[model samples]
Target: MKSLAITVWGMMALPGCRPGEDGEGIALVRSLPLSDQQKLCLEKMVDTFLPDTDTLGAVQLNIHRFLDKLIANCYPEEEQKSFINGLDILEGKAQDLFSKSFGSLENLQRESVLLGLDNEENAEEKAFFDFSKEQVILAYTSSEYFLTNFTNYEMIPGGYDGCVDVPEVPFKV
Candidate 1:
């Protein structure tokens, strides 16, 4: 019955989910406000937050791009602008500290820059950094690599039980 319902809903949703004109997906990518340098800075920022260890990092799982798309698609326009501005703010910090872009900073410098985002001088930077940390953690934990290897994801949620009492009476259906 659940499968039947899903099929019905899928069929209903199929028509509204058509692809773009030129066999493209997410044509909104071109429309996104971020420049290439900003995207690179974002990648560097997320990587700095979750550097590769024994396991792959957030950037390895494409969390940077996922974040970009998330902010572009899900956040309200006002929020999207704020986040972009936050990126600019970080860039400015990098320039002020290292005389270079955030993407050009060393790993330690990147770490320092990100760690200092919560200064009292700007409320926007604090809000943006907090939201960014939350989203990066959320994306990392939910990635397939983290789930399948680190936490042992269970698709249907079952476990083995050693001692199980059988039904006293088994009635015929």
Candidate 2:
């Protein structure tokens, strides 16, 4: 199952795997079945999950876009519904804690709210958050930008050293 997931993810990460053929600067959430507000909220959530550093972020690397495509194209309908509903719950939690939308909250406040949710005992909410977080991380790490730029991953590994002599050991049998 893990291998299957990795294979699927690899396929999705291929060039030209985008859901649509728009030029650069295209918003990936536009192709998803979510509303504008939900898209904003999800983008903000993704940004928080993988924020900007001295180098790059989820937003800059378009991990949110990758996630949008992955969820829309890969996830089953029930899972999609659960994720959407989870977004609603996340936004509600933000409002309850900060009296504002999740996208509008200060960074520290947003972190606090998310931390509270992470520690909560709600099974469904936790599942949704965990699933979304996992997908986001997977998509980002497997992305070409990260693989090629942030990591030492090479398409081909160094040549094998096949000339080494085998060491012999005494057998108890």
Candidate 3:
């Protein structure tokens, strides 16, 4: 199963599944029949991880969809099932710790939770948490926000002197 999963993932990684194309942004999940819990958890995950940058956030990039595809097509059955089930564990813990649910945790609270997950001493949970977080970052950065806002390339160019001294203006006209 692991081998099969790996093979499938390799295929998916072959550039055809580029993170953003057409209109298949992060909105794909919204069109699907996700459970209420899954929806909430995804929303929480997005809100928690996304920063107000010029680049695309995870939600805009449809990372949840990518993740779904990865899990269904690439992850070993056990790992995929474990993650499907374990999402609740993360969500429940976030709610218990923050008292506002994972979706509702304030920025500081979410940060604390994410940091705690990252710092776990448990080998298994730590590995899974780190994997999940890495995916989250990937999804967010590849999103349209990052693609559009983080970069600027002008087709036209003008030559400017590499070294020039500006005259100081004495008055603030």
Candidate 4:
């Protein structure tokens, strides 16, 4: 379990390591530059990328909050602006398409919007989506739920079985 503990510590110590920032209890998203509408839109975007499965979804894993912390703390100022601007573009696209905010769309509508964005040749939109998708995947896979339930990971592997029954040698001189 030492290795597991180390891995957990390593994850926690990533760029913006702050003590007691469990990505669960702290309302760090509020401290981010994003407004409430933007935050909600981000949450919806995360849900679109990682919806509910048998396992915990992005929302359940609190990946949105994790992403907010990562962006607000870990990422550079330019990257932060890019991400927020990308979000604004996404929301604008949603509005242009459905006449509603992205957060208010149904699941299929959200998926459609994302699909459209993914297909578009716009460099900025593509970069934003790619960046967001990468972060979401990283956050989800490194989450406690993924480690404990999906991987069933152990710090130390089980003991090796070395003993084997020797076959009797017939007519051994």
- Which candidate number has the best lDDT? 4
- RMSD for each model, in Å, please? 5.8, 9.4, 14.5, 9.0
Sliding window of 10 residues with minimal summed lDDT for model 3: 25-34
What's the CA error at residue 107 for candidate 1, in Å?
Answer: 0.6
lDDT of 4 by residue, 1-173 (tens): 99999999999856444445556444444446899999999999999999998878999989999999888888788999999998899899999999999999999999998888888899989888889889999999999888888797876779877998889889866
Off by over 4 Å in 2: 1-30, 156-173
- Give model 3's clash tally: 5
List per-prediction Cα lDDT, in the order shown.
Answer: 0.87, 0.82, 0.67, 0.88
RMSD of candidate 4 to the true fold? 9.0
Compose the digit string of candidate 2's lDDT tens values, residues 1-173.
99999999898766444445555554534446887878888888888888998868788888877787888877788988888898899899998987999989987887887777788899998887788789888978898888999799988889889799989998897
Q: What's each prediction's clash count?
A: 0, 0, 5, 0
lDDT comparison, 1 vs 4, better candidate: 4
Which one is best on TM-score?
1
Tens digits of per-residue lDDT for model 1, 9-124: 99987765677687655354433488888888999999998999888998899999899888888888998899889899999999998999999999999989988896536788
User: Where does candidate 4 clash, by residue pair?
Assistant: none
Worst 10 residues of 1 by lDDT: 23-32
lDDT of 3 at 28: 34
What lDDT does candidate 2 reach at residue 43? 88
Ranking by TM-score: 1, 4, 2, 3
Q: In candidate 4, residue 22 scores what lDDT?
A: 57
Please, what are the lDDT tens digits per residue for candidate 3 over residues 112-160? 8767767878665567677777777876665555656666633456787
Preferred candidate (lDDT higher): 2 or 3: 2
